[model samples]
Target: MSSTANWSYTAQATIWRCLGRNEDGILTFDRPVVIKCDYGMNARKGSLDIGRECVIKNTIWTEYGKASVGDYLLIGKSSEADPISAGAEEIIHIQRFADTFERNADDYALFTGGD
Candidate 1:
């Protein structure tokens, strides 16, 4: 059986791959790629909170090798859409794991981000 057979990847997102900065010290990204994954968001209390704009606690679980830190993620967006115009989320941290017997799934990457 496939390891990911029971996995629930219910969300769709676009990944803007980072391609290093330019001479002007501006980060650049390649074209976006659409992917399926499990997505979640939470509101946290902190000094950064302002009105209803609390800290965004975002979490995403997807196949390994899909994305990394510095890459941008636009949840509910597609590759053909403009990420900047649609509000893209930055990937701050990534936790990768290999499949295990208890959690029978393919190697996966967990992306956490939001300000």
Candidate 2:
């Protein structure tokens, strides 16, 4: 596998760690953290799911750390300035370097999810 530092990141996004739901049944999140990543969208033309007539899949790659499944990812916006205005997508999957490999600064994480 190629090192993460070798890849060029063209976009930025903010990640909010999910702190789980509250007693009232509302989800709460921690402070947002900005990360540099390479983002792309794939158009699924012939999806079998009728509920999703048109599906667009979003994928992102960034340095491995501070993110996991169920976290909130806000694209094209920073939560520091206006956290309430932007809508966040929940992270469904995370692909990271295997533990079999040696630890290095160049390791990366791949995140897949979004409407």
Candidate 3:
């Protein structure tokens, strides 16, 4: 593990819980979702980058060399392109590209997950 007060890593992580405060109080809810991605921040520049398929809405917490809470994705443990989180669960995959490509000459598409 390279330690410079900043580092980068990828892992297959499961969304264990979604914490929120209701009338009762703070609580943890079920949000079992898994994702594989490449994510990290450039400590020097204070810049962060997420993979094409990884959509990070928010980061909950970071502890024990891992993020404890948040709705985000990060690089998986496998360096290979093979996806790690594969199963019957519903999953949405996102891929980013430099430019749009002609799908069938009749249509154009952008890989940025947006119109």
Candidate 4:
């Protein structure tokens, strides 16, 4: 039997950047995925056992002290953002933060904190 289970997770952006020229705009980020917590009643150890149709709440990205809700969906194990193996024992949350930025002419906005 496949041990892999579907889990829902939330991703929040610590720092977000955008480049715009006139009406055209581009959204970019250094590291935009902060897992707040797992959603499920069946939890084991420190991770939660969330299988199938996971829901994430309060998923937003922040910039210049301003935050915008981010749209994302948990695609079980084996995702591009974070990879997981089937039949995994535990599901550890991943948290990432932006420390620095690259030089560019585009406008940059620094996120202070949560919205």
For lDDT, the strongest prediction is 1
Screening candidate 3 with a backbone cut-off below 3 angstroms (N, C-alpha, C), the clashing residue pairs are 10-75, 10-76, 11-75, 11-76, 11-77, 37-74, 37-75, 38-75, 60-69, 60-70
All candidates: TM-score: 0.69, 0.67, 0.27, 0.19
Off by over 4 Å in 3: 1-11, 16-19, 44-115
Cα lDDT, model 3, residue 65:
29
Tens digits of per-residue lDDT for model 3, 2-113? 2311232243444333355467884443444444323333222111244333332322121122223232233222222222232111122222222123222111111111
lDDT of 4 by residue, 1-115 (tens): 0111112224222222222224445333223233322233332223224443333222222222222322222313222432111211111222334423432212212211111
Q: Candidate 4: lDDT of 84?
A: 18
Instruction: Give the CA lDDT, 0 to 100, for residue 23 in model 4.
Output: 45
Q: Which ten-residue region of model 4 has the weakest summed lDDT?
A: 82-91
Regarding TM-score, does 1 or 2 come out ahead? Answer: 1
- Sort all candidates by lDDT, best to worst: 1, 2, 3, 4
Q: Which stretches of candidate 4 lie over 4 Å from their true place?
A: 1-24, 40-67, 71-115
TM-score of 1: 0.69
- lDDT pick, better of 1 and 3: 1
Top candidate when judged by TM-score against the true structure = 1
Candidate 2 structure quality by residue, lDDT tens digits, 1-115:
2353445665788888888889999877888888777777643442323453333356677764768777777766575633344576666566675433435544355444444
Overall local distance difference test of candidate 4: 0.25
- Ten consecutive residues with minimal summed lDDT in candidate 3? 106-115
